[model samples]
Target chain A: MTSWQIIILASIAVFALKLAGYLVPPSLLERPRPARIANLMTVALLAALIVVQTLGAGTRIVFDARVPALIVAAGLLAVRAPFIVVVAAAATTAALIRLLT
Target chain B: MSTARSSQHKAAIRASVAVGIAVSAYGISFGALAVTAGLDIVQTCVLSLLMFSGGSQFAVIGILASGGTAAGVAAIASSTLLGTRNALYAIRMAPVVGGRWPRTLLAAHWTIDESTAVSAAQTTPEGQRAGFWWTGAIIYLGWNLATLIGALIGNLLGDVSQYGLDAAAAAAFLGLIWPRLKSMQPIAVAVGAAVVAALLTPALPPGLPVLAAALVAVVVGLTNWLGPKDPLPAMQQLDLGEDGFP
Candidate 1:
């Protein structure tokens, strides 16, 4: 299928999911699993995104200075460093280490 | 139900849309990277439009380019699996939209990362709905436009790193994730998931490790290892009133 076709199909599917969620009553959403899963999903999704970004350097998982980048980024976040500083520090650290090592 | 609340709703909508714009612009990095990786303009845009899920979109293209079809499929599956949470957001947000067809369409498009966060943060039902639609529309339009522009300019650029475009989305994502680490459970979950994802990276493909990490997070939260009661505060408990937005 063409990209447009794929997009249209996917859009429809996503819309359907939204619609289903809308139609379902809120009481159902109060289920332990839904609530539990939802909360878990939030943190997990963010973690997944971060992990993928830090590890996958153009298709391969380079465990070089990226590890240090990850650690530094997490530490900065832990210590409440400004967002831009934390990210710039991490990326610059990674690149410099890559160049050096 | 009240004018004051409606106004607050409007304000929340504006905030969500603004935040959406700020976040969605980061997609330029993804668009540029995808094209640099050999994906056509249409293919990259379609991933954004169809997948509409950022992590999965990146994972699919990343794996497909890496010659890891099986791993790519796994990544896509895992990311989509993690994406199930957005549906839950829809459940909470549906009441705010209240079956208005135009609003429903808006809600459908706006059910993304930023909008969900905005909606969850609001107290009033009206404000929540307003946030859901406004933020959703902003992200939808902003992301598409950025993707198109990024594809055009990104295709012309030699190395994306030269422009520092490669780190833009990661930076933006970190900005979003960093602010939410309020307490121990979330902090623990984030740390654990990151560690797991890192450990799995060399062993798995681009998306799999993250997904696995997310799965572990799910288990931790479900088992009360993450917290005792709900981590998210009940913003509605105070009876902010039908018209009061706070």
Candidate 2:
């Protein structure tokens, strides 16, 4: 299929998945196991995304300035720094590293 | 609304606006990148409007940018995988938003990470609804506007990497997730997922690694459910309320 077709189909699928979540029985969602998994899934997925975004470029995983930038972001987060500060600090760290090297 | 509730709503709105703007900053890059990746301005906007998921939209553009032969399939697969988390968000949000079809349909479109997080952070049901709607509206507006601006600017914003906007998404995600890591279980889960994704990066496809790492949560949840009745102090401390972290 073309990109247009793909986008349309994918949108439908995404909407369906979301609607299914609402349609699910409360009993199923209230179950301890599923609830716990859903709770932790966001954290897991976010962490995974962070790693992939930092390390991977297309299919190639490379250690670039983003590694240090991520470390800086994590440090700022550990200290409970403001969100803007953490983002700016991390971005600056990466920019400076790239500039110097 | 009472004075207290009104203040809470104001605070939620304020926070959501700030996050909306920050998240929209990334949208500028996405718009420019999508165009650079050979998509027309209309197509780029359509992705932002219809797909509406930043990570998945980026995945499609990134695959196209790489000029892969199977870019279509790869983009769809990668984007679909990243979009699954919205379903999880929906499950958590269903009870709070309730079952009105028209409203729920709109809610489904906005059932993204930012709205979900902002809503989940509230202490009241009204606040939850307010948070979700406000955040979703702001993000939708901000993201689309930024996309238009970025697309109009086009390649003028050359080499987004030099400015470190490339890492902006990851940094933003880190900031969002950091506040939620209240105890050991979550921290462990985050670390385990990150490690798994990093390790699998070289072996698996781009988005599949993240999905594979999600299995870690499933495994842990299953273990906690089926295994011996060892009480986890940290898990017990989790506030399983509509207002609490999910």
lDDT of each: 0.60, 0.71
Candidate 1, overall lDDT?
A: 0.60
Candidate 1 — number of clashing residue pairs? Answer: 2
RMSD of each: 5.4, 5.0
List each model's interface RMSD. Answer: 4.5, 4.2
**Residue range B1-246, candidate 1, lDDT tens digits:** 488897887889778766776656656756765675456798778777666665445544444434344454454455455456556667767777756787676576566656766776777877776776777777777777777777776689756444443343344345555655656776788888878877777776555676678776678756858475754432222111121110
**DockQ of each model against the real complex?**
0.36, 0.48
Worst 10 residues of 1 chain A by lDDT: A1-10
Q: Which candidate is the best by DockQ?
A: 2
Alpha-carbon runs more than 4 Å astray in model 1: A1-16, A56-62, A68-101, B1-6, B55-70, B98-106, B117-127, B159-176, B202-206, B229-246
